[model samples]
Target: MQSSTKTPTAGGRAAPAPWALVSVLAANMLVDALEVSANLVALPAVGAGLGLPVPQLQWIVSGFAAGFGGLLLLGGRLVEHLGRRRVYLAALLVFAAASLAGALTDSAALLTATRVVKGFCVALTAPTGLAIITSAVPEGPARRRAVSLYSFFGAAGFCSGLLLAGLLTAAGWRWTLAFPAPVALLLLAAGARLVPRDAPGTRAPRGPGWHATAGGLGLTGAVLLLVYGLSHLAGPGREPARAAAAFAGAVPLGALFVAAERRSPRPLVPPVLLRHAPLLRSALGAAALNGSYVGFLLVATLHLAGSGRSPWQTALAFLPAAAPLALSALHSARIAVRLGPARAVAAGAVLAPLGYALYPRAPGADPGPAGLLPATACVGAAFVLAFTALHLQATGSVPAGLQAAAGGLYQTFVQVGAALTAAPVAALYTVGRGPALWLVTAVGAAGACVALGGLAHRGRPRARARP
Candidate 1:
């Protein structure tokens, strides 16, 4: 782990320096999320470096998710137990070391190990960043703004990573892996200087227990099985025997996770979260919405530029979608406050699929600024609206103590949605651009349906958002 140089704050406590502090927290979360897709543009380079089989490549990234997503709850607990300041610094150092190691390594095993380690660091940091937001910024708009920045960075980092990876991979794969090192260094320095210090809680648990470890292992295996099963069965050219086996494999793990969680004393994921009636469905909506939303972005980009679209044109087209989000986000809080979170999320769900429905009608037809622009704008804007509302609805419903865990659970669902349709989403572009997009649009509608049934109600002023 990389060492942090923290400064003393009020009460002679070690803390991060104050100055647009929310931006700093957002930056940290953004960096972590971007790593999810950071290597995509450099896949060829990384594959060569690691001597990877074509099939093994996804593991390089999925392994990180396996590490990060699995440990997120544990990471939050560790932060509470050890003190956010210490955990934040230690996690940054780990990330830095892994980034450096990734840059220097040629061995697939070594690079993948570093990625997994970095992911572990990221898991620790993400929830802690929100915790920091809650602690540092007082409630209401201040914290809301901070969280907005965090979410915004996440969106921006993902988009930027693709662009940056493209540029760097053109130079060499090392640049893509190495790019994060300097940023990590800067973040470490800033974090040490600015983040506030809080002493370890006397009552906080010592560390993660077997129950927690088992929970993550069980849950991840279940999710991976589920993803593989669906991917193979529905995806093009998929083998029947293998797909059947994958489906068979997923069933036991899913059942085991449910049974295990129901009994564990120190449960990996607290069962209460899974049982939250409104959240259970809303989280599914968030996952489904994002899965198709990001899926569209991935395939749309590939279809546009995968063949011959120039870098500038690709950037230009995406920007139209990107630009409206910032403007629309300014109104998200107000809309949620007035309209309620459930409706807000449902509205976004409708808009995204609606945009997809339009794709076929107006395939490549220049509909001027209002026409072509609004379609993608709906996709991005809906993302902002739904995700923000999900945060408000899911987290706000929970007791204060359970907020981080709830947030993590919500995020896990989002990842599940994203993971489920990789092959199906791929088939869209691989099969035919128009047909593939329409399929994605239909999937988006399916997600909207999930949101509408469970978490998709209206007009009740509930708890306000947590930063």
Candidate 2:
């Protein structure tokens, strides 16, 4: 792999600073994470302004997930085939444009469309940025630190988005949409100066064949349909028929994608990644963390609302869950080195369920912020311990050239898993919030089991790069 520690400039002048490159990438990741949580707070305002029903309002959030989760794998390939810097820059430009358009739009459908467009843009940038970090920062302690910093930005962004959304909504929901445009532009300027250009020889010698292209398209469509279905189940409309149709349609598309991969000279997903146990476990662990957190957020907010807390108050109450994540960036590298990534992940996974189980189960029980701290703090600790480790486990095992694809796969699991887990949990909310919490706890336990399972193969050595 080419050294990203420093790159030669054309003028032989001082090169762009390495930390600057990482900051540009990490900041963009913050933008992506912010988008996911921010709009959710603005959903009611959006519905009131656009005169849309609950179902359409739900799309304002779900549309982004569908587009992002669906396109990630293909976006990763594009980064591999094209250059990471090229794709990253172009995606940022499009993201800025989409954010601007979203802010100006009055039509509900147009707002959702812009969200989907921005999601596609994020689909390109998020993994590309991750791939850049993995390739640029050599493996071992340095890479762990870099990955931890990247993961911290994401966790912090999600937390920041909620608070920002609360503040911005008072000005009007459009500000929520408008906020990221300038942020993207700023990142774009810095990225152009900072992100190293892809080496001339970095591009693939040959592009995907017709079979691979077909398989890629099929796989993307299948993922889109599946996520869309799963997301709608949790939407306020609760349109089971539409969700069922999407689910039913995805089966055949997925089967065809599998068949095509078998026949293609170059498959959409590398076969080696398929057999990689560590990556798979990492993906599942991330899924459990994200899904349960999302579900808990929904259930917790509803519980708080029942106690007459305003949305702003609810956002504040969750601070315990988000603060540790940002701080974790500083120490996660040490934790990973000390405990091993797998063990760290498993240990963190165990904490989440314990926290969920500790949450006050009765609807009438109004746990003040202080009472809620233990639960939220535990969830936050889970992220501190596991989130960065999960990223490390996912990409560390893959070849440097395939880092982007591995990132895409890992993120896909995270996004789609949130939808899948949150759906049934949401449905169970009507039955009882306690059951939803139990479900989230169960998922966390299952994730912990999966991570623990990876520990059995004592003879298998870890994949690493020599510094």
Candidate 3:
């Protein structure tokens, strides 16, 4: 790609802030994050307006996760082959079109289809955006700052969606679906201007071989089946047999994919990469961060709405979590530098479970700020520490060429973790909120243990054997 250099002005003065490229990238991150949570608060209204049955309504959310998570590996490869700038811009255009279609469609099926399309577009763009940032920015404080800001925008987007959903759903659910269009278009225009073009003499790489292609397709199918089954677990028409079938079908598919990968000339995911300890750990940490956070939000939102609180009130209650999360993200890079990313992640792990544990102690209906504040704050802190650290840890070790794939792998875990935890947590809520909170607590504790082990191991210097 074209290098981000200082373009001279008419007066022979250099342009201000080479970091403007990061702004374009962060905007993409913001839009991607916005899509994840915006439809959440608007779901009830969407169901009513579209006259969708409760079971089908759940698909509106799960569909996106399925498409995004399932295709991320392939999407990453596409970025590698086709070029980052090309893939990113094209994805934005597709996203805008899908958003427009979603807004205008009256058919629930068509709208749901649009969500999946938009999600696939996000799968392409999100990792590519990160890849671009890492490639463009020099590693160290500048890259760290860029990643932190990028992550902050994502967290902020989720919070913004919660509030925006309340307002837009009040006007009409369509507004929530349509909001991304204009924002995406503006980003597209700015991106065309600011984003450096592909390097001269660089042609798109050839596609993967048959074995790799087969493995990728099979793996994507397995993931989709798994996510689909998990999402159905807590729905109104809970069908154990169907869910079981889907889960069962995924096993052989996944195994076959692994087998195929072993034989492929050029596997979509390099086998050696899988053995990278830091990358694996970061993937696990990403999963834990998202699973616990989304699980907690799902339960908390349900509790508030069930207690006769309005949508606005429920959204407001979540402000404690969002506000602290934003602030923590802003400063997390500094914390990581001081404590080390592993230790920072471990610290987050501890806080997350502690937060979940506190939630169960909150008194009867409408547990005021006094009860919820500590729990939300802890969760927020966990997010800031874990999310930023994991992003750095996952990408820091990878070579330049594989950075896009690394980003894809990291994000795939995130979506899978969120989807997997959400259903079980929703089911637990039916039993009791206490059970749900306890489950989250257990998960957090486990994640913390992993992080701590990594920290202790990293701290100890390697001993040399006597010659």
Per-residue lDDT tens digits for candidate 2, residues 1-467, read 12344556688777765666777899899999989777766666666778865445556655686567656666666777778899999999999999999889888778877876787899888878987887776689778767767877887898898899888976888898899999999999998887878888998766655666666667657766775676567535567898999999998888878898788776767777777777888898888888788777766765775576755776788888877876667777678768888778877888888888888997678869777999999988988888888888788767777775577678888876765665566566656778778988898888878777765542488654221
Instruction: State the C-alpha lDDT per candidate.
Output: 0.67, 0.77, 0.75
Clashes of 3: 0
In the order shown, what is each candidate's alpha-carbon RMSD?
A: 5.3, 4.3, 4.5
Q: Which one is best on lDDT?
A: 2
Q: What is the lDDT for 437 in model 1?
A: 73
Tens-digit per-residue lDDT, 41-77, candidate 1 = 5655676667664334444555565566555655666
How do the candidates rank by TM-score, highest first?
A: 3, 2, 1
Candidate 3 lDDT score relative to the true structure: 0.75
* Top TM-score hit: 3
